[model samples]
Target: MKSLFLAILLLTLYGCDNSQNQSKPPVKSENKEQLISPYFGFLNQQKDSLIALPMDQAMESPEKYNYVIIENQVSPLGFIQNKSDNKESNGRQTAQNFANSEGSLFTIKNEIKSGDFGMLVNQAFLSQYKIEPFTKVERETTPEVKEKLEKKYKRKISKSTTVAVLKDQAEFNLTVFENQQDSALAVFSYIKEDQLINLDFPATYDDISTWRVDDGGQFDNEAFQVLTVLRSEAGISFVSIFWGAEGYELNFYQPKKDKFTSAAQAYGYSSPL
Candidate 1:
């Protein structure tokens, strides 16, 4: 049933005819700045990082953490299908519809880090085009394992660690919000010393008119090539989650508010560390 639904969705979004895999006109890049205008205030220009919005605070006011809308604006959800020919506007309304397609008006990314960290891999895919012969990682939280981790890292275990794995990539699932309906699926969380890194991606949609993707984990699924933490010599810190090879999204943390925020396609970020 899911396969059938996805197929129908692809047809509706793309077209009934594939034209033998014919390509469509490229989306306009001239308006990229305009499309991303809404997200200007949320970014941290001085640090070249997305504001590290606190998950707890964001949950306190979910409406303020509309990261998905920014994502939709920057990438334009339907841009992946690329069936439009506006050239000038590049399916602005369609992109907005795509943003709200699955009851998610917008989404937010949260970062949760702790020194004693682990992952649990439910499923993994090779890539978006080729998904087969996947890998599965079982969950384990035994005392002996914890002891081994403590001995290896030389740090006390704060919480049980579950290490999640992605095929030729890295991603994890952590739950920060008590209510599953209101919570975002945490992609990665780890602790290093006093630093507790928690990355959350929330799918908050406003409209469900377009085709919906059932899985909430779609954002982190093959969304990036590498995900790792980076700290500047000046004590400034951020996480660089890179897509493809060079493109990256910077997740930053603010101490005063005790929160987190992110920015896509950061300018100063040259290499992913």
Candidate 2:
């Protein structure tokens, strides 16, 4: 009887160990590569040239394109690479020059020369990457909802500010700070079924010095503007543009499992003066 009791106790302990191991979450692999959506790309126009703002790893063969162009209402025009030096600065300068120019709209050319750089775009390269447009619904806040948000966020809601709701059901509330500065910052809040799920900027500068230098104390004037919404293979994404005194920044926000997060961002056009 003593030996049988000891055996049963050992088996019970082993079963408990197996159950604990099964209940614990699996270890995530460190070697896994981050996934990027194929539909992700920035749109900007310069004169007759449709520019795709340079984004990191935005293309499979980013080496081949000196420029990325968009024609008509298409999402991605194509990839163009400057064969001269294959330098990013050259590409940016080429884009900036086109952006600064003024001209009528035109179609994408296989090859074009802007400033000192000559770029070639492969029309077939981005054929697989396509995005569908998302609807932007403008909504007004009710008195009760406004008061609830103001009290919860500890910031006064702006009556004049517009609330934009994307097709994915994410809401953006642009609120003005009540301090003397009265900075016009966006309170990115999302409501699902009339319940606030998330509230915060899609992205923010980590360093105060970076914010000061990049924004140039233009917080009061800067506001979030919806550039476009895209539906890609990865999921739905919203692109927003913020123009400060120093330059303009584009932020891509996408829905994750439960909340929206910043996927990528690109800076463009600081005053040469």
Candidate 3:
């Protein structure tokens, strides 16, 4: 159910289509400007690294924070848009607040891969494909583990390219908007392009699940991979997986930290964390 667009082919040609695999166009080599988009998710996923955004503060009303961005604006929903009252934009409310108090209009164009993230990752990927904060990291792991993790992340992000890959380069635009007293909205047109991707692709959730997590006491099935760990001390800790499958994986270290939770990752990210 990919969104059909009039001339949307700016950069989405790289979407996985095994049947079209043979004739797939050459991977686009993007410049630093283009590579900046994928990091939009990093902002939301990494908000906890900020002391000001307490779990409680993060859950505050929509008008609170001030940054909103569209990182990889590939989808129709990703564009900043207002839903008409007449027909449903897949239930989009024409308005909705975002994590940082900036309201969101989720077109593949606006928020996630903002100029901030694109610039950062483009430079970082010069050395590696992904980047996370030193603060967000709990402790170090074996070089074997680190090496494996890097490979896994690179393989997964392969579906979305930039200066990082040969696929269509994705980019985002960040904007600041005040919260509106309105219902939740769909920022981008949602697609269930499930069948097109190979199940064995490392970026897929299944591959992430099997990536050998031994985060000391920080193990949670919900939070997987450095490329996608979402932490909110206030709500719940989670990581978005396999494109956009959902749910938070509550994490904590108990006495001796002997066991862990294995609940399936949440869908919709719909309910409260």
Candidate 4:
């Protein structure tokens, strides 16, 4: 189906509650590595406290109107507002997936976007969108076939001592560059697979780019090669779990790090990947 493309994902980490701590991700407990069970809970009293304040005042029955209006206040716009504040890059909404059928590559709608906590957003501002036929090829530049690619690209595109072209396969790279003017543009292929799928990109992605799918992510260090187990003092979720797959992080969420660690420890494969 057109909806079955395998979009890549990054990592997640724990965060602290706003009451005792605000705006900071949760810290990992020193003893947490020894405890990988998912029996945990936390609350962001800031959210609850907000709910209570209005309710308490409403219950007292104000002289004007005895009613509380608690709005979702999630700031759906906050997601894009953040990037606007950064003001260097624009966000693009992307829809991508992998299909077990043919012509699936044409379905990749890679958009450049950014994010903050709750959810990733796709902005319609000045963004670089991508589109092309999977069968189209300008050149090929693999070490094994550099000569062939050079010849192929020379005739179709620019002139280079060596050239490379994108096709409908899983071995490509996407690069987005923005200058001081905040004008952004991206160039990429119809396919590419990363060689080092690790476990720390999703969270990093939330802090930065939404278009940062699995293979397109950058790592802070080799530690990302393994699982990143952390706990959050922030809210309902207390644990964070990160797993490595295909040289990229598959996903990141809270309250599961301990469970994942325990499983790895039990299997005696807790070492870095």
For candidate 3, the C-alpha RMSD (Å) to the true structure equals: 25.0
lDDT of all predictions, in order shown? Answer: 0.30, 0.46, 0.23, 0.21
Regions of candidate 2 where Cα sits further than 4 Å from its true position: 1-60, 63-72, 83-96, 99-140, 158-160, 163-171, 179-186, 192-199, 202-222, 231-236, 257-259
Predictions: Cα RMSD each: 24.4, 12.6, 25.0, 28.8
Any runs in candidate 3 off by more than 4 Å, and if so which? 1-59, 69-86, 92-239, 243-273
Pairs of colliding residues, candidate 2 = 65-80, 65-81, 66-80, 66-81, 66-82, 67-80
Compose the digit string of candidate 4's lDDT tens values, residues 1-273.
334432221111222233346656788867311211111111122222111111111222111111111111112121001011123312111111111111101110222122111111122210211122222123433443333333432322222111122243533222222222322233222123322111111122332433333423332222121122122342111112223222122122332321211211110011222
lDDT of 2 by residue, 174-241 (tens): 54434324233345554545655332542243333223345433343234566545455654555666
Comparing 1 and 2 by lDDT, which wins? Answer: 2
Best by TM-score: 2
Per-residue alpha-carbon lDDT of candidate 3 for residues 46-85, written as tens digits (9 for 90 to 100) = 3221111112112222212223222222222222332222
Full ranking by lDDT:
2, 1, 3, 4
Q: Whose lDDT is higher: candidate 2's or candidate 4's?
A: 2
Worst 10 residues of 3 by lDDT: 183-192
Model 4 quality (TM-score): 0.15
Count of residue pairs whose backbone atoms collide, per candidate: 37, 6, 36, 25
Q: Is candidate 1 or candidate 4 better by lDDT?
A: 1
Assess candidate 3 and give its lDDT: 0.23
